[model samples]
Target: MNSVQEGRVALVTGAGSGIGAAVARKLAAQGAQVVRADITATDGGVVVDVADPRQVDELVAGLGRLDVVVHAAGVDDPRAKQRIADALEAGRPPEVTASLDAEAWRRVMSVNLDGTFHVLRAAVRAMVPRRAGTIVVVGSSSAFDAPAGYPHYAASKAGVHALAQAVAKEVIPFGVRINVVAPGPTDTGMAARTPAVLRQAFAGLPYATPEQIADVAVFLAGEESANVAGAVVLANGGRFTV
Candidate 1:
């Protein structure tokens, strides 16, 4: 790919591993100065929990000059996953809303939804002053497709997608483009830990590599996608026809 992002400054959250790490690597390769942020910092990355608004604000403010931002930090509650697994084992559907664990739900939302807001808000504020920026938020197909027994994950991602769309409209006038990439099942450490029954939902389908998803994110962040805004680019391998 071309170094279309030459000389730009980019920030990618959740850069410790998985898709976030891939995105950070790709952005750097495209000639951008990439700042990697995560709860657990690595590779000279800044340590910050996106769920904390103050930390996110500090991270972006310290960047000095921001042009591209990719919000990929998120979590699927392990407690909820355990509940779903136990349900499946009992030959029953996963726990419904009534029986869902409140703490688990809040944990997922804090990171996946609230965290996204903090990062995106900080990035946009920094970019609005310059009137030139692009943000790519990593969402999930579960937002639209609704995975069984994972309300917290689904709700958080759905909120993320909506947040991107709403913010995209608000910032376009200031030359900032915010978009979402809703990927389906991907080959990542997070996916590897999912219960077997849940994984089988995409049995016949091939899992997407982190690099593949990163490619889409990079495209959205570059000049090639200049006209695209408030769009959710689905990279779900044809799992959902709609």
Candidate 2:
């Protein structure tokens, strides 16, 4: 019912839960006709594995015209998460750098980096002809500094940031703009699963809600941020300045 994003169509990936779900709802509230895609479709959006190029291509092709594309779908398996959480504990056993779970790292990269690549490629395919669109990628602040425990997660996110910056130039001539939103520890289901000890390290920064991050995402997707492209707007709620 809002006129802010009326007539603007948007596609939100990983819309089943977490930040992706929040972004989809925010776009809808702003009056955008939002199409959602996720492995588990919670809001009646199509089920999609963003890592699959075929599925990503079909989803965007079906939309015909897209004003916004939000790629929020990413993965960090339970083992990897727990491994990082253990690091928060005092006197935790030291892990050999070479003994880490390589398979888990691959899964993280495939979903986080490959998934992002698939979505961006498909969005460009659909938007270039129209010569207009905004692509907003949900990146991670960890990418700014790949910590010891979560090396894979950090690398994958860094790849996404680099990809967006590189792709932003290619899409410039066609009138398409791409940007990234890197958020710090957000109070979502994912963050809640982590121990408080780990989160307390950044006590100086206020915890951000899903809605707060969505506000920044909506701004980047709309005309309000026309001059902002190829920029990584860190939404860490003052936790870190980068």
Give the TM-scores of the predictions, in the order they appear.
0.96, 0.93
lDDT, model 2, position 40: 82
Which residue runs does candidate 1 get wrong by more than 4 Å? none
lDDT by residue (tens digit), candidate 1, 86-146: 8887898877677777787888999999999998889988999999999999999989988
| Alpha-carbon RMSD of each model | 1.5, 1.8
Total backbone collisions, model 1 = 0
Model 2 TM-score is 0.93
Full-model lDDT for every candidate: 0.90, 0.85
lDDT, candidate 2, 1-242, per-residue tens: 45788989999998888888899999998899999888885757899998788988888888878889999998865565565567657557425345566777788888999999999999998889999999999999999866667778899999999999999989978999999999988888777776676677667877788888888888999999998889999998776686
- What's the C-alpha lDDT at position 161 in model 2? 98
